[model samples]
Target: MGAGFSRRAFLQAALPASSALAFFSTSFRRDSLISAATSTKPQKVIVVGAGLAGLIAAFELMQSGHDVTLLEARMRPGGRIHTMRDQFSDGLYAEAGAYDFTDAYVLLCQRCFLPSR
Candidate 1:
């Protein structure tokens, strides 16, 4: 759930850059919500997958001022971040197929990791 939320937020943050500006310029002007004085509006975007790369891209696009939606094929998010904690004892954590993260991953984690419940 947390990963899903984070993914959504990332997409929302990067909405603009990922969309077609020409499309947004023409389509959004039709909305009564925007006034003639308002020349431009945010673009609508759909992002496939919810992995670190996808989510990061979505976030970057959204941060540029667009609307974003994220879609995932799996039942849960976290992608390769999946764990098998339940299969291990307390103080033990295991990655089914993934190992440690990289420097870029560390940067992303610092910038976008979801807040704790």
Candidate 2:
């Protein structure tokens, strides 16, 4: 925790950086989807929520040449995932909501977030 570090500012900065990383990640192959396709017609899809699952689904659908519309109830995309700052002693912060990833989801998360070695 730094002197002028606020959750809002941190999120504002992190969002773009993370987005850029995702966009540039080697795992995000736009041509892979096209290459594996069976030459079917593109479909329109509507995805509810902007949480991790919804976002990933939408992105995958879009990459597969489908039209996707993502809807979120909150002002931000991360459903219950958020950070709380200045709520504890000595600049300690807390992460609220779905912060833990179980073993079942480990592979999916790694595939989505990590680069191949």
Candidate 3:
């Protein structure tokens, strides 16, 4: 055997490629995989509050074949996104909360910094 050659080493390297080949050639169609997910039975889901997080959760649950009802105590859908037009001049309004969405905010969300238990 050569200085850098062994049967164990060759088998370890070839296993992953062969496994991938078998996976791709399976009977399941790759392109229609999304459409193949069977629609789940309709379930009743009540979401508390109409905040951004609550709205997102409700939307996702509805898409997965669940009947979602949003319950908001406030008069508006946005929880803390308050705008007062009376205090400002004519044709003017003030945003008391909720900053503008940006690309950096998305990049920040993509990163996971918290340690898992």
Name the candidate that leads on TM-score: 2
lDDT of each structure? 0.64, 0.72, 0.66
For model 3, where is the 10-residue window of minimal lDDT? 108-117
**In each prediction, how many residue pairs overlap at the backbone (N, C-alpha, C within less than 3 A)?**
12, 0, 0
TM-score of each: 0.46, 0.50, 0.47
lDDT of 3 by residue, 1-117 (tens): 467988788889889997996578465553353243225567788998886556655765666677889999998987777888999899999887676643323433444343322
- Cα lDDT of model 1 overall? 0.64
> How well is each residue in 1-117 modelled by candidate 1, as lDDT tens digits?
375578778888677655765356445533342243234567788988887656764765676576889899998766777878898889999777456554435556667664322
Q: How many backbone clashes can be found in candidate 3?
A: 0
Candidate 3 TM-score over all chains jointly: 0.47
Model with the higher lDDT, candidate 2 or 3: 2
Measured on C-alpha atoms, candidate 3 has an lDDT of 0.66
Pick the lDDT winner.
2
lDDT of 2 by residue, 1-117 (tens): 488998899989989997997568546554554465426778888998897767766766786788889999888887788777777888788888885664324544666787323
Clashing pairs in 3: none
